[model samples]
Target chain A: MNPANGGWLIALTLVAAMLLGVVHLPETWPGWLGWLRPNWLILVLFFWVIEVPHRVGLIAMWITGLFVDVLYADPVGLNGLILASVSYLGWRFFERLRMYSVLQQCGILFLLVLGAEVLSVMVLGLGSERPWSWHVLVSALVTMLVWPLMFLLLLRLRTGLRVE
Target chain B: MSALLITLESSTRLLDPLRSFIGSLVSPIYVVAESPYLLTNAVGDVLATREQLQQKNRDLERRVLELSQISQQYVALKAENDRLRELLGSQGRLPYEVLIAELVGVIPDPTTFQIIIDKGADAGLSVGQAVLDAEGLFGQVVEVNRFTSRVLLLTDRDHAVPVRINRNGVRSIAGGTGDMGSLVLENVAISADIVEGDRVETSGLGGRFPPGYPVGIVASVVVEPTSAFAEVLVRPSALLDRSRHVLVIFTPQPQIESNDANTDGVVDLDQGEAAPATNGVENAQAGAT
Candidate 1:
């Protein structure tokens, strides 16, 4: 077994990739072209949770989520808590996830993303004075559509990680 | 371990130096990651572009047309310039230290609509300082970091500015409508000369803002005879959607420190007696209205 792989560098790269994934959440393209926002981070997190549940688990997700909170300037710990919960849930359900096909996995991931969106809205609504709108629903839909590509890329990245 | 944990917790305040050292170490990485690009064209490129001179010719034609129109205005301006010499004279000496800052980004979240400026506390920026563009008032400084400050724009619903009608001198306050372009006039009399096109300026009523700085121009008038107040709509003159640069005006106040120190029972009694002079103008206006 090649022991030189899956070090801190790989974990840091995963974090960077996950952070880059969130930029897709805010774009509004022309007409139907706009509906393609992939929940890149969630899909990446899902793949990593299934591949190496120990290395990139709940705590890692929580810290990355906190970084995202600062980067996006949302209420501190809102995304962190949600992302950590999602990672924990994903790891707990990793056995069932391994048996599923891409389509079934996408559907499950879509539901997870939807739940996260709802939780984020709830957190923001509690902290903010502004009225909630239907825009978040669109973002949830975009996250669902982006899942397959993110899942595939993350799966490919995981193949390179030599698990001990 | 429990005793050690308690000691560690107690000494957390002393760890600030360590935290700051770590922060400085990480700050360079952040700066490199987020720094905006500045492009420079060489003189050789300009010489090469001399072949494609049509754009330059077009630009010169536009300038000539603008110059002729400006010349016509200059003659009229030169004649009336002496008549309005006092207004022009006031413009000669701007009262505050105006620092120019470029608007870097607008935070899209409606709940806290803030804009980040290129200037920070390092550029003499402080919280509550006024930000204005060429046309009118823009925002106020809220959060100042080392390299940048966040300004809460006037159109934010939480923002309110004390203003007066230039025509009637009727003092009132305007609040933002969550739309940076519009403002709502609060507590104005039913009968006021706040017509469309009437300019509004900072009244220095609260001393939070400087006097005579243009706030906005009146956009509409909604008068209801049954209501005690008129619904005045005003559009801010600042081209907020397009303006990149703004002037952060620093108005230093000496009275705040004095007010803080003078918080005593005897001071309260003295303040009560002195309140009549301060409230006299507002009370008289309220009574008349």
Candidate 2:
């Protein structure tokens, strides 16, 4: 398999998962299993941004954010801006992150997820005069806590998609 | 390398056809991705069956208590009406049409605090439609899509619902302060008759929402000396987070207004339009369909 074909496969899988994450309608509130949400999209994109920075750059994040914006009908460009910023940050630290073990990478990814949540709340809550709640912080914590599983999934995909 | 080059030449030529075929095959993946609950629903059913029974028991107890309170309210309302009638003339009752819809999901973000409902354009729902539950005003429809609509919950930070204290008729705008069950009364005078347990209802100042729907009950009142205003925290009347269904009222005002505009044009064309005749025709059409 050509390297270019492998990249396309990864891109296709990411977009498909992201879009599915957007359209999914939970029939009932499984508050117990609420932890199982596909926080995978951000982590996958993060992995690509770190490993293949040029291929999945700021533009890819922006488009994913816009897709989520349309799917959720949130204030337009809010999520896109946050995603692009995260991608940029991920690209900048790609070399540094490349040196770390999976467990260490998971710790840093937790912080990145927290930063993303804060950026989302700050952007959306600004000027709207809505009272800020601890829920945003809670969500950020939840996102970070899921880092190990998210990282493992991305690791599996990377190995599976590797071409000889 | 030579064999690969030959294969690439053939595949490059077929790329357009192959891409479209691949796109078609992958389209269903997104749809399947959207229903993550389908994977968990069967297991959830077995687990949730006992919990559902317990929830029903709790609901029954709540209903009994609500019934007793409602009876008390009716008696109090009748007494107030009699007193008001002696002071000022009675105004006729307002007519409204109610559409019932089920709550589908809570919006993922807390900033917007919107709920997506299953009803949409197909249900004759228009933007800015007022939504209410049996107890009180819940929120309004802000965005409408094909099969679903987004409702900006009153508890959302950006939204402001005009409300008045039922005790002294002190009016103030209530804004969401990032809580699922709370809102703050902005710019109310320090002397306002707002107290804990006071009922707050829509003032109907703006034609945005109909009058007299219960908004919430005052939870706490805090007055700071430095500030010229008082802080009133309210717990909304409807159990919004717990509510599974809501009523979207569709009053007949728009249709009436459009017909009146058409009547004016008809009268100008004909020397005298049959006023009583048009009334019967309009009434019959409204009744028939």
Candidate 3:
């Protein structure tokens, strides 16, 4: 972390990701495009958690996710739980995550996002859940596909800005 | 701490103020998120032709002319209905004031059907005020901040409206199934005169919503001989996913902010004057025939 800004650059990136995650699609856009709206906040947090585990860990991710919960008007802590559970696994596997190629990390990210979905269902309950659509896996698969580009972009931003 | 919050926030609304405050803090984020749609709508307006504008103007003027004619008769009919209600020893209908508000955003989650309106507590809005579009009932205001409120639309899985059949005056309940286009009427007996295409309107039994506004049209009725209740599907008459402007209704009757922790979202008309609105199982059995 920098001496003067104290990680404000990281804070700005997370806020930018939160804003982008929620921008609505055009009214004339097709309905199926909604399934492709990746969980932007988590993807960015995964980058920061994997890169700077000493600074950005479960608590920071949890608080950032609380803002997402507010944006979506979800119950206050559901997203916090999703972010914390997912990022904790990222922290656990960081040495190997850093060693692996981006595509392989994409595979691991898919499992983490899938695990987050399972946590969401368990917390929210299956009483009124939609019929098994397999879209959960599709959405997770899409989030995984998004990771390599997102990772490179953030890496360039960190080095270009000299954030640390 | 998050586990504690999850339990406290869901089981009881011990966390509502915290949620509302955080929701307000996030409004700036919402404005940034909505800018793209705002830009597109502005571009569409610029591209519209003068002839199209004239056509829309003519259609609005014709609509105003027709509505004025209906309202003149409505005043007379309402006065006469009040006299009859007095004769029958019943409560007279209180007048309602309507305010117009624009939709700012629709909550984008697939699992919920909620929208944000531009008006809020500063505009005299309160939780439980009924919302409507030109065509039919839309939803009710659930959370009111300084500048905006969240409306739980009629199709949210947690929403239920007390309704009546316009054809037969039979009372029933319509519960949302998390689908934007339809709601499911609960516990309809097989013999109930409700049929496909029957108009369903607010019954005004719960007193939260004003009675007689169109809620939905009966889309289908499935009566299996072995099953005890008919599966009544209602297509909401209002365009839940399309409408841009809505009307907020202020019914003159005093309201108790319905606490969802206790009631199943149906509120009492008046705590002192009306029979208990809480006993729904018996109420359904009594009203189904």
> How do all models score by TM-score?
0.66, 0.65, 0.88
Q: Per-candidate DockQ versus the true complex?
A: 0.15, 0.17, 0.52
Q: Which residues of candidate 3, in runs, are more than 4 Å off?
A: A4-6, A126-133, B255-289
Candidate 1 C-alpha lDDT tens digits along A1-164: 66645756446655565444322212223323333445556766677777666656566676666555444445545666767877888788878887888788777877887787677667655433445655556656776677677667656655655543
For residue A160, give model 1's deviation from the true position in Å: 4.8
Alpha-carbon deviation at A28 in model 3, angstroms: 3.7
Residue-wise C-alpha lDDT for candidate 2, range B1-289, written one tens digit per residue: 2223223322333222332233233333433543454446547766777779799889999999999999899778867777787678765434578899876656544345667677766788765667898789888776555555667777766667777888889888877765777988988889877889999998765445677889999999999999999989999987777676898877444323345456566444432221112111121111111
Scored by TM-score, the top model is 3
lDDT of 3 at B197: 98
Please, what are the lDDT tens digits per residue for candidate 3 over residues B1-289?
A: 7778877765565666776677778877777777777777899899999999999999999999999999999999999999999999988877889999988876766666778888887899876778999899998777776778888788777677789999989888888887778999999999999899999999977567789999999999999999999999999999888888999998885445444344633343244223223221122222222
Provide i-RMS per model in Å.
Answer: 10.5, 16.3, 4.4
Q: RMSD for each model, in Å, please? A: 9.1, 12.7, 4.9
Error of 3 at B75 (Å): 1.1
- Give, for candidate 2 chain A, the lowest lDDT window spanning 10 residues: A27-36
What is the full ranking by lDDT, best candidate first?
3, 2, 1
Question: How many angstroms is residue B274 displaced in model 3 relative to the true structure, after the best TM-score fit?
Answer: 9.4
